[model samples]
Target: MTDTQAVQTPDNVAPVLVVDFGAQYAQLIARRVREARIYSEVIPHSATVDEIKAKNPAALILSGGPASVYAEDAPSIDPALMDLGVPVFGICYGYQCMAAALGGEVANTGGREFGRTPLRVTETDSVLLAGQPAEQPVWMSHNDAVQRAPEGFTVTASTEGAPVAAFENLERQMAGVQYHPEVIHTPHGQQVLTHFLYDIAGLEPTWTAANIAETLIDQVREQVGENGLAICGLSGGVDSAVAAALVQRAIGDRLTCVFVDHGLLRAGEREQVQNDFVAATGARLVTVDAAETFLTELKGVSDPETKRKIIGREFIRSFEGAVSEVLGDRAASGQKVDYLVQGTLYPDVVESGGGTGTANIKSHHNVGGLPEDLEFELVEPLRLLFKDEVRAVGRELGLPEEIVGRQPFPGPGLAIRIVGSVDAERLATLRKADLIAREELSSAGLDSTIWQCPVVLLADVRSVGVQGDGRTYGHPIVLRPVSSEDAMTADWTRVPYDVLEKISTRITNEVAEVNRVVLDVTSKPPGTIEWE
Candidate 1:
């Protein structure tokens, strides 16, 4: 295949097309599909029939939305998609749309199901509900329901709220559920979805991280050729570490990882990368201590975007310097470093408007804030993978658990964690508070449960509080602990009260800069995971 064609086609990658019907569960469905080791992508409902067919998806999934089918301008699917011969599965609002499109009766049922309901299975021989319990609890949220199945479809399941809760057209390989199988509240939800993906659609689960790593290594080898040199920006996070390791496996000693210490990282992050990563991957690493340079540039800057731009610029400069040093005599001998490896993930790409129908949330430093006239060709091996997938790949590459299990940290590091100016004293205070939060969370056995707890320093805001002896004015630290399937959306994690108390007491007593500790109970809708 030509380079352009090869870039378009991923070998052995089976993509499941998720048509978003404006539902919150759309991303959840995508994550569940990836958890099943099947690659999936989300497209807008506005996509044409030709656009849908262009993807050549192994299966199609219609996600639930909030729109009613009877309402004007409600999201609707093309009637011709049912005849495309691809196996299709619909959930919630998707189920209503498919039913109305395929000559089924759908109307406003007086009974509106909002929570868990008992499902009665009438057909065990159906492939969609095979090996599932006859009476199962399913999470539902809908006002209208399907009253009849489409022609050639067998009504296999029902609920009190709707008579035709689930249906299957075996011959055409079509299935749908009135409730979301992507939700965890439904106990057998994943099993039902897996049945549709594997048994009904006949798709193989071959999208493991190990397989992805192998393919990326080959691609990197092919792109770099025999004698080219590449440099990876190692940020001590899972993505960068895994990306650097994979590139090292591809080009051996030709890959030199440049780690720029920008004075905004958490405690001991640099040493972790220097000792653990180097020992694990055996890749040549160059550590540049440019903390003073970065802090000097960011002396009085308090705006998050401006800080990000300065950090990105300084990072590129540091990376260029490292490249020059690594290329010492080789550049004079006509050899050049032409590749810059990054660990940019799918969420980063999607959040940055790199995906179809996705909104631009914020600009990630590595992905969107880079210098336009940079010299190196970008090599992002994990660009299409998610955070959990990156962790799996890191483990598959035999990286230490410390590196593989490390939580996601921003490219701008602790500078963004502080809600105000970026400085040495503020950095130190926030770092101490953050370390205490990390320690207590880990001690309370909540490390893996909570994604990443960002102890934010509200340097611009201070409150009055009575300490042990007298009144004190100090910065308040905001503890943002979130739980998420992916970083795209998150819900606040309810940490135990005891654990919270300990974190609060320790931060106030140990680090004197802060007088109060507040928990951020906001979810991702109104508030992002990060404070700034």
Candidate 2:
């Protein structure tokens, strides 16, 4: 899902390429395809016919985007791509595109449908909507709708906004729907996607967690060679931990796991990596105490990107130094560490603009923040995997529940959690607040319900509040509790009032230099889950 295209995938499964037309859920569509046990990836819409054919894709999925089919400069695909003998499935904007490209009619009928709408199936013999009920609700977001089916296609379904909402040509092995079938809001979305992948495209479901583990382990073993050595930096998160575990399984003692206590992690994270992870996997461990070094590099830095890049550079330096200390003369003579293992996930790569035509949201510490002079080749086993898939692999590897089910933690650590300059004092304050939030969420059994609750310290912002009997001006702690499948799109978790009250009350009472506790109710677009 992240940079694993064409030549990179060592696995034998032919990939299902998702043609991204600048839609937000392009990655989601790819994930859904993978969920169907079909290896899938996203390709830019600009990819030429021959460029796409080189991958020898099992099928091609056209992702929905924010564009009208009839626009003068609308995104267009080469007509020859349709002539290829492969199954094609399009959604929303993609449906309109397919219709217009096949000489069907498309126009803004002034009928706009957003959110869950009732879809009426017109044909029961449809391939995509086969055996489905006559009436069902589907998630739709579009304006310009397809008005007619092309020469050999059948109009299967329709909505109030558009008449030709779903169309398919059985002989050509092509199908499309105007509604988003990848989201949970549409009850039968997965079923329809499965139908297309299986009944129409004849794709097999081979992307299970066990299969993923075996494939990734094989890839790591092949890349690291028989005697090559690799070092993985443990970030105490599932991504890094899973990546380390994969490398350890690939080349047992040759993989040295480094725990860099950069003074930016949570209170008990260093201990978790030093004790729990070691006990779980018996990985060759090298602990690097670079807290002071990280603070020095991050001194006077408040910009999120700057902080991320600095931390990334220092992390590589820490690994490079550890290589010399652990390997000694061997490193000097030629047995230098050949790889730097990172727990880089697909979301990290996507947010870092790993996709074509994707804008950089923020530089993830492991992905976009590394310096140009890095000598070790990055072995990101989890780069093509998402956070959820990484967890599955960790569980498959028999790691402990605590390590495998740990919450999502940013690689930049507490530096980005503090919205201002990160000092020892500020880091301490955020750690305390973060710990309390985690404790409360876990105690309430809400850990399984919500994705992550980021406790941010607004170091530059302070307000006046009465502590006991005196006016106390202290920094505010913002609690971001969001629920998401992947870190891509998130919604504010609808946590119970009692749980929020407990977290807020505990942080205000226990943590010093902080009196105000505010909840960030905004979602991903209007605001990111992290404050910085």
TM, every model: 0.91, 0.97
How do the residues 1-532 of candidate 1 rate in per-residue lDDT, one tens digit apiece? Answer: 1213112335556589889887876767888998888888777788789977877889999999999998998989989998898999999999989889899989886978998999999998978999888999999999999998999999999999889999998778889999989877899999989999988898899888778889888888988889989999999888899999889999988999999999999997888879988888888888999999999998999987778778878888888888778887788988889999988887776666554455656667776667877888888888777788888888898988888887789888999998878899999999999999999999999988999888899999999999988999999999999998678778999999999999999999999999999999998876878876
Off by over 4 Å in 2: 1-7, 328-333
lDDT tens digits, residues 445-516, model 2?
Answer: 998888988889999999999988999999999989999887877899988999989988998999879999
TM-score of 2: 0.97
Say which candidate scores most in lDDT: 2
What lDDT would candidate 2 get against the real structure? 0.87
Clashes of 2: 0
User: Any residue pairs clashing in model 2, and if so which?
Assistant: none
Cα deviation at 10, candidate 1, in Å, is 2.7
Q: RMSD (Cα, Å) of candidate 2?
A: 1.8
Evaluated against the true structure, the overall lDDT of model 1 is 0.86
